[model samples]
Target: MTSARPLPQYLVSRFHGWKATTYAESSAWYRRLVDEGQRPRAMVISCCDSRVHVSSLFGADSGEFFIHRNIANLVPPHAPDGLQHGTSAAIEFAVTALKVAHLVVMGHTSCGGVAGCHAMCSGHAPQMEEQTSYVGRWMDILRPGYDRVKDLPEDQQIAALEQQAVIVSLENLMSFPFVAEAVERGTLALHGLVQDIANGSLLQLEPSGRFVEI
Candidate 1:
């Protein structure tokens, strides 16, 4: 059990800030959209963490992004899971259905799953638990990085591996039939982004280790 004092103050403050925006949406506008769904221009794959919100980063409204959040923004190739992969579902809807112009797989700094990627190899990670659901499954995409940098400090590896995983996820996305066909026809653009959470910055991933400010 945890005490109230252990909670972070930012949550309290941000919730209040959110209420201001939540109140700004007129009821009639929401009703119109609810009855008739708005088509979003892009699909963003981001982490489920509360702090890494791509919608807020892009200044998008409720239905403006066909956003999908996982433990990390992982896109596994379409296989035997089901006809509906949540991340794949959003991408297919964006490209093949809505015909969105862009699809971005965004990574971020200070991710817990990046740390968990390191932790899993340490023989200390929890196994087969509900709370560990997505992290355990999705973080597998970063296994190569985790093994490569097992000796690095958590803070350093978080940025490095998160960016690497972003690229890897992008590669995985190409394996999907819809995404591949769309790219081949030049109908969609794929972007890889890294959000620098520490300095309140958004960094676009360079092929090198550096990320340029957007």
Candidate 2:
């Protein structure tokens, strides 16, 4: 990249505005957070989509929630294969080190990753079949959930898959022994949620295996 193609003016200006206002007004809070490291009570695993803003939705202050975002907000089964596993590493830190009380797996509507997984599983996306495709392999985590909801109507299938993303992540989270031990000891709780992009409605999964608006 050339120096001429520098950072966008709009983003730079917005950062300046934020530094002048929000950061300036809360400098002490920022200092305290810096001095005393973060001890967030919950760990939120959410989709990479910008529309799903966990902090903004809950009006969370800094140092409140430990947030991790990835394509489809996926957590693969516990694989201690001595390889780098980003999501598993985050989960381990949150559960064993930070000792977060809750683990929330949040998904949302109109998720391109989930939609891509749907298409790939349905044999509609040929490119994803290639062994070199990273996205295709990552999205394979959602394939089991997709299989469960494939019989639904086309319009409903995507939405169901979105919710299924949350379920899949939650199930995978439990596969980590530390997370399950924490839950068993009453130190950690797991939650699954789906957010509607357009209307801003939230649905939480219940014990009965259904998501109801909350």
Off by over 4 Å in 1: 1-28, 81-84, 122-134, 147-155, 207-210
Give the per-residue lDDT digits (tens) of candidate 2, residues 1-214.
6558668899999999999999999999999998998899999999889888999999999899999999999999999999999989999999999999999999999999999999999999989978899999999999999999999998899889999999988898888899989999999999999999899999999999999999
What is the TM-score (0 to 1) of candidate 1? 0.75
Candidate 2 vs. true structure, TM-score: 0.96
Query: Highest lDDT among the candidates is held by which one?
Result: 2
Per-model root-mean-square deviation over C-alphas = 5.7, 1.6
Clashing pairs in 1: none
Candidate 1: Cα lDDT at 160: 73
Against the reference, the lDDT scores of all candidates come to 0.77, 0.93
**TM-score winner among the candidates?**
2
Put down candidate 1 lDDT per residue, 1-214, tens digits, no spaces. 6555644789978876776677455656777778988777788888888899787788887778888888777777667565556677777777888888788888888888777776675667767234557667667777766666667785676667787678778888898888888888998888889888878787776657566888
